[model samples]
Each structure stands twice: as C-alpha cells, then as structure tokens.
Target: MAPQSNRVVELRIPSELGYEKIAREAVATVAHRLNFTKEKVEDIKTAISEACTNAIRYGSGSDARMKVVVILTADEDKLDILIKDPGASGAPPIDIDIPDIDGMVEGKRRLGGMGLYIIRELVDEAGFVEAADDDEGNQFRMVIYRVEDTKTESSPEASASGADNGGSP
Candidate 1:
C-alpha cells in the first residue's frame, strides 16, 4: 500500500469482558501489515486491549446489549485507533496517574484504574477525544507511529512524574 494511502477497519463488539480480544487480534494483523516492528505491534495490542476493556466495562457498564465500536485507521506511518462507548460511566478521567502499585498492594488504593496510564505509556498519543454537540458517549483515541522520531522524542515520565527525562523516548 502507498505510504500516503489509508486503510480503515471498523468493528462493533458487544459490551462484555472477552469481546476485547477480537479488537486485539484485528489490530495486530493490521499493524503487521503496516510493517510495524514486533515490539511496537505488541504494544499496540496491549493498548487496544486495555482501551477496549475500559470501553466495555466502564464506558458501557458491560450491558451486553450496548455495542462498543472500534475504528482502526491504518496508514503507512502510523495506526490510529478510536473506541466509542455509550458513556454509561459519565466522563473519562482528565488525568492519568502513574499506577500506585505499592499502594494497591498495601490496601491503600484500588487495584484497577491503570488502563489509561498503561495505554498512555504504550502509544505515541492517547486520550479521550472531545465529543461533538450531538455526540452521546466517550470517544477514546490512540495513535502509534510505525517509526519512532528521535527529534521529537518525549519521555512519558514528564507526564507521570513532574520531572522531565531530557527528551528520551
């Protein structure tokens, strides 16, 4: 496929626990076809899984009747993913905190809530897209570049930790 051309794949899965696996496998195939490295493909898979899980569980409340829509836009340079849910859980989080594993183990914090953080770390860009006036639910977006750009490299630590990493990827 031409580098400038785009291929789009859309999937609508039931709002249930195991359905996210479908999206995972579909994204993996697309990433491989786009010539993404093995490591990057793995990252994309995990990120999509987490995003879809969040959509099914929190976004649609696992209603089963509701459907979670996943849109995969494959380009030569990057793969863009958009997941839409019915927003049964209201607004998505404004911030993604570094997972407090220690606190969770110590019984000071909740065990889950790490999905968004993990997605942010794995992909080049990840966040909930602002919905339009007529839109009803949440639209989460994630983008993974096939090739890393060293010039614009930015570490996730700057967002997770207040300190900067001197532009390390």
Candidate 2:
C-alpha cells in the first residue's frame, strides 16, 4: 500500500499491447486531477505508453500472464509515476549514456533509442528503480515537478467529470 497522499491511482493489467491504453488512461486521469496542464498530461501519457510498450514487448516478451502495474502519486508540488513490469527476470543494470539531441536531430545519430531520451526531456526527472520488495521485476520511475499557479483553473469538462471532487483509485 502507498502512503496517504493528495491523490494516488494504481492500475494493473496484463502485459500485452491490448492493455496499454488502460495504463495511459489511468496516468492521464491522475495527472489531470492533480491540475496538470493538458500538454504535460499528454507528455506523461506518451512517455508511459513507450515505457509500457517496452515492458510488454521486451521485458515480458508479450506474455499475457505477466502483470504491469502503474502507480501514480501526486502532491501539491510534484507527481511521481512508477511503472513496474514483473517479467521473467529482473532487468540488468541500466546505464543511460546521455544521448546528444542535436546529433540525433541532425540525422547524425540513429533515431531508435529515443524513448528514454524523450521521457527525460518530458519530465523533470526519470529513472529506473528497484522493483517492489517481494517482486522480482523492473520499475521505471518518472517525476514531474509542478509549478505554483494561482490562476490554474480546471476545464469545464474535467469539472463535469468530477475531477475537482478529489476521487481515488
């Protein structure tokens, strides 16, 4: 169980392409409720989609039985997202050598390894972390810091959907 916070949403689903939307939707919902801007929420959604795709296609080998769990935590100043994939085995240590965005944009470097790069660019901080204590798995943690905005206002659609009512999942 996660510590009590302003908002927390947890989602678990099979490790398959068919379930990616669930993860994205859950993240988006939590982010929206946390008062994130639409663009930031979309960025979180895209990054999460890539991470989950890698987890399903590579980590779990597309196994439908394996589970992918996503936990979204939000406070007044930050939103932390953890995406866990309990694949066949734990992932080897990851050493992310910083990629040169300029070179990649200029076609000097290949465009294949942009998932993590894009994630890093999108969020304030992002990294892989140890999985749950009892679970042999890999976890990707992404953090986004929220800037204080006194004028921040919820859209009518979000208000109509009860986002301002402080729901939990």
Candidate 3:
C-alpha cells in the first residue's frame, strides 16, 4: 500500500455568535472524508463547535471585525485541529472545570461555562497551546484518533479481564 500523506484544511471565520456553525459543518465534511464513524464525526463536530464558540465569544470578544482561524490536519491515524483567535479577552483559562449545572439552575452560579469541559470530554486531547514571543493570539488544539481497537489491552473489557495483570500467575 502507498504511504498516507497528511491533508490540511484552513478556515477563517468572523468572530461572531453564529459563525461557529460554519466551522461545525466544515469539520463534519473533513471528518467524513477521513472515514470516521458517524458517532465520532458527531463528536468532532460538537467539539469544534464549542471550541469555535469560545474563541468567538471570549477570544475575540465577539467582534465581527476580528477573525478566528481554524486549521485541521488530517493524517492516516488522527485528525489535529488548531484554533487561533485574536486574544482580545486576555489569556485563555489554564484549566477546565466541570460545569455546575445544579448551581446554574438554582440561580447561584452563572450559566454557560461548560464549553471547555465539554470539548475536553469529547476529544481525545484538548488544550490551549502556549504561544511564542512573536505570536499574538490564543491557540487551542484538539486531536482525535481515527480508529480505536476494541480488543486492545487498554480497552475496558481487557482491563476487567486482567489481561495486564503483570504476570501474577
């Protein structure tokens, strides 16, 4: 078989409330082309949507004049996504915390802070990349593996069966 090459797709969208949907659709098309399963594709789409929404709302302050950049790198094994925003709202959060849904519903905690947490859970890896001295924006990255082997030693079933029991027998 021929060697697989990496394919990249870049998109620039205005930093507006509704622009995230554009990114959502674009990622869905790319993920489908990479032959990802329907569930995985849906996950990717949702993850990208949340990330882009954060970039638009917080990173660029939802300023339509600002632009949010999305870069997707597709390889045989995985897909890498990077989102760049103008950093108008200062630095990105250093850590992600689970949403306080109960508090929000009870009018104690503020609503709509679950984007990062959702993104983290949906993607294999999700984080804000540190920028170099010359860089001026926040760069957030997410990676999703294309294939997952159900019978691997790390699988839940294998672990439950003690397949990695360190030769205790």
TM-score of 1: 0.88
lDDT of each: 0.81, 0.68, 0.79
Estimate, for each residue in 1-169, the C-alpha lDDT of model 3 and write its tens digit.
Answer: 2117988989999999989999899998889888888988998999899899989988999999999999999988888999999989887776455577899999998887887766765776677877778979998888887765533423444333321111100
Give one digit per residue, the lDDT tens place, for model 1 in 35-114: 88888889889989999999998899999999999999988778889999999988777767677899999999878888
Per-residue error for 50 in candidate 2, Å, reads 1.1
**Clashing pairs in model 1?**
none
Name the lDDT of candidate 2: 0.68
Ranking of models by TM-score: 1, 3, 2
| Per-model tally of clashing residue pairs | 0, 0, 0
Q: Which stretches in model 2 have alpha-carbon errors above 4 Å? A: 1-4, 89-93, 97-111, 148-169
lDDT of 2 at 19: 93
- Candidate 2 lDDT over 121-156, as tens digits, reads 566656776666796777777777677232123333
Question: By TM-score, is 1 or 3 better?
Answer: 1
Runs of candidate 3 exceeding 4 Å displacement: 1-3, 149-169
Which of the predicted structures, 2 or 3, would earn the higher lDDT when compared with the native? 3
Task: Give the Å shift of residue 145 in candidate 3.
Answer: 0.5
